[model samples]
Target: MPRIIVAEIDSAEQRAVAVDVWRAANAARRRTATEARIRRIQEKLDTAELALLAHYGPRPAGMLVAETYHVDGVPLPGYGHLSMVFVDPAVWGSHVGTEMIRDLQSRGWEGLSVWTRTDNRRAQRLYERTGFTDTSNRSTLRDGEEIMQLAWSLSET
Candidate 1:
């Protein structure tokens, strides 16, 4: 693998790359509504506090979207919440996510938090390697009761 470079996604074209990455990453899941998923991700991007894309060599390999960290609807000061994160399955085990997390850490913040599917042990390990800890807070996604796990990381930035 080539170097991982993280940058702000700047155009509709870049957003499309993000959508592609999401679809490819979740291909094994029981999801099929590509149009709806794209729309939903776009809506979230429109409001995201920060949206990033990671490139492995010249190909977009990952997407991360974060906003104000919140608990019980209250914003957590100096913290960012990752609402969406995905990496192209082709690049699994490649540290595209580690690069994205490094980018986030460079941004001045007290801490960052993210929610991952409980069954996604791969993502959990990545977060743990990047200094995130399980926060013991869990929730169901908008469409179902599939468990989601929360992890928090304090940034050296």
Candidate 2:
């Protein structure tokens, strides 16, 4: 069985694991896993309200980042923004992502919101299956990738 651990986001070991998982999961769609990019991710993790790393025995398998504040341009209250969730491609169909979201929901958030690339249908399906609904709002990242916002009401859980 896999277990989740509260990550010390600023630690070198955790950061390296995060960057490795991210690169392995999204290398095709993202730029090379440069140190600068990993540093930026560490910065975000430092400010996040919650950061978790999932492990299957001794191997890192996934990560989740969440914040109490709403996502940019979103006006919702009592909602936690799920800033990031990434699972190793080797475990893509192993319920790792679902476990991460459930862990977040168990944190007492009234609701959860996330922004995902519009072209990432697999991620969309996963979120939808986990009870997130499309808010129909869209935004463009600095890299010009279009993103859609989705929200889940924890009250219904």
Candidate 3:
């Protein structure tokens, strides 16, 4: 059986693992950022974010970077915005991605949102299954790829 571990990534080793996941997740879809950018992002994580890792046994198979921030002058509590989520290609079908989302939701992420390329049907399907709904919001990355954002709110009930 596969095991999922949600560690608050802190040490250099864990951060390196996160970098690897970041590369794997964005491979073939977007241009990998430079070391400086990765460092900047990691700095953000180290400061006010909670980073989660999904472990398949002893190896870190996937990870998520989430942080809470206000939007449009509204203070959304426990609004976890997933900045990056990556599962190793070798373990793509092992349900790590789903497990991460479900686990985080269960841990009290009242609202969540993620953006994926319109061409990435697989990810879209996974997000939909995780209760995210399509929104009209669209984002353009630095490399010119158009991404659509999907969001899930626990307040509906």
Candidate 4:
């Protein structure tokens, strides 16, 4: 059976995993993000308007980051821009990602959004399964690579 827990990333148990996620994301993208970059990300996490972790048992399996902001000049509810939902990759297809999303949804998030590279079909599918719909919008990463933007809304039904 799969287990999922939602807790603040500031928790002692989650600190290392948060940094690990940054490393994994950078490595997966083939970017040479240095220790400095990792520290900078940790700093942001420390002050992260909102940060949450998705845990499997006693392990920090994944995380979510929400900047808490407005879009298109319109005020909205809590907007969680999902980031670094990385599974250890050693255990791919183990439903870790799905469990993570479920945990996040249970947090009562409403106007959530996420972005994935056009070529990252795996991630796109995961987001879709979690009720995120592609907006057909595109943007470039900080490194100049093209990425497709996707969004999700918690239905009132």
Candidate 5:
């Protein structure tokens, strides 16, 4: 089996690889990247407090993006919001997403939260396997798709 390497996206090479992975992984959103969506992905990567790339062997196959977990402009202590966890479609079943989530878990966070489209069962399964639970919290996206928040359980950490 090829090794999985996870690291901070710290250079132009790393950022480029991460973006490429994001491009290929946009299917996670159940759509291809429209020009506008591509732009939005770039914008998010630029602004995210932390960006990480995961390599399955030599290929950058996953990217994880995080920002301070906050509400109403107030930051939550020891908490983080994972804005994105993308695995290239080529590596869809390879546990790259699990490795990315575990990287965050190893950071000693009090909690981490992520939102997934309500209908994205594959992602929900990954989250569940990696120890995140549905908070029963929900919201509607701009496109009218519903999403639910999943929170990491302290006991699991």
Candidate 6:
């Protein structure tokens, strides 16, 4: 079993471990534009309202970031945003990501939302299995990539 720890965003050590986990988790998908992706991840980590790090014994294996702000033009009340969730590929099927989501849900979130790359069907399936539904809301990144927003209501859990 992995140990889940709330990240100390201001701590350099935790931030470094989180970045390493993020890189390993997204290694396959981030085939190019490495520097840009690293920068984006760093920015997200720095600004996340909450962050969690999962460790398998002594090794960092996963990370999650939550933000409470509403997306531009989208009105969400009592909803928290799941800004990022990444588990090392080596532990892809170990349920770490699911556990993280469950942990978040247990915190009494009225609703939670996440944005995933439009082409990331695997992530979509995982979210759906965890009770999230497509909100049909789309957003484009500065790099012109499209993403879809998914939401889960605690009342339905």
Q: Which lDDT tens digits does candidate 5 get at residues 74-120?
A: 99988889998889988888999999988888886788999999998
State each model's C-alpha RMSD to the native.
2.2, 2.9, 2.3, 2.6, 1.5, 2.7
Candidate 6's residue-wise lDDT over 1-157, tens digit each? 6664434356667877888888886776765637887899888887767787776657677788887747596856678889888887877776677777777777778999999999998789779988999999999988799999999998988
**Predicted candidate 1, C-alpha RMSD:** 2.2
On a 0 to 100 scale, what is the lDDT of residue 96 in model 5? 91
lDDT of candidate 6 vs native? 0.79
Give the lDDT ranking, best first.
Answer: 5, 1, 6, 2, 3, 4
Worst 10 residues of 3 by lDDT: 23-32
- TM-scores, one per candidate: 0.87, 0.83, 0.84, 0.80, 0.92, 0.82
Give the Å shift of residue 30 in candidate 1: 4.7
Q: What is the lDDT of candidate 2?
A: 0.79
- Candidate 1 residues lying further than 4 Å off, grouped into runs, are 142-148, 155-157
**Per-residue error at 75 for model 3, in Å?**
3.7
Clashes of 4: 0
Quote the lDDT for 47 in model 5.
74
Compare candidates 2 and 4 on lDDT and give the better one: 2
State residue 136's C-alpha deviation in candidate 2, in Å: 0.5
Across 52-138, the per-residue lDDT of candidate 1 in tens digits comes to: 999999988999997888879998888887788898988888999988987887787678887777888888888888888887878
Residue 129, candidate 2: how far off, in angstroms? 1.8
List candidate 5 stretches off by more than 4 Å: 27-30
Q: Could you tell me the lDDT of residue 142 within candidate 1?
A: 78
Among residues 3 or more apart in sequence or in different chains, the pairs in candidate 1 whose N, CA or C atoms overlap within 3 Å are none
Candidate 1 vs candidate 6, lDDT winner: 1
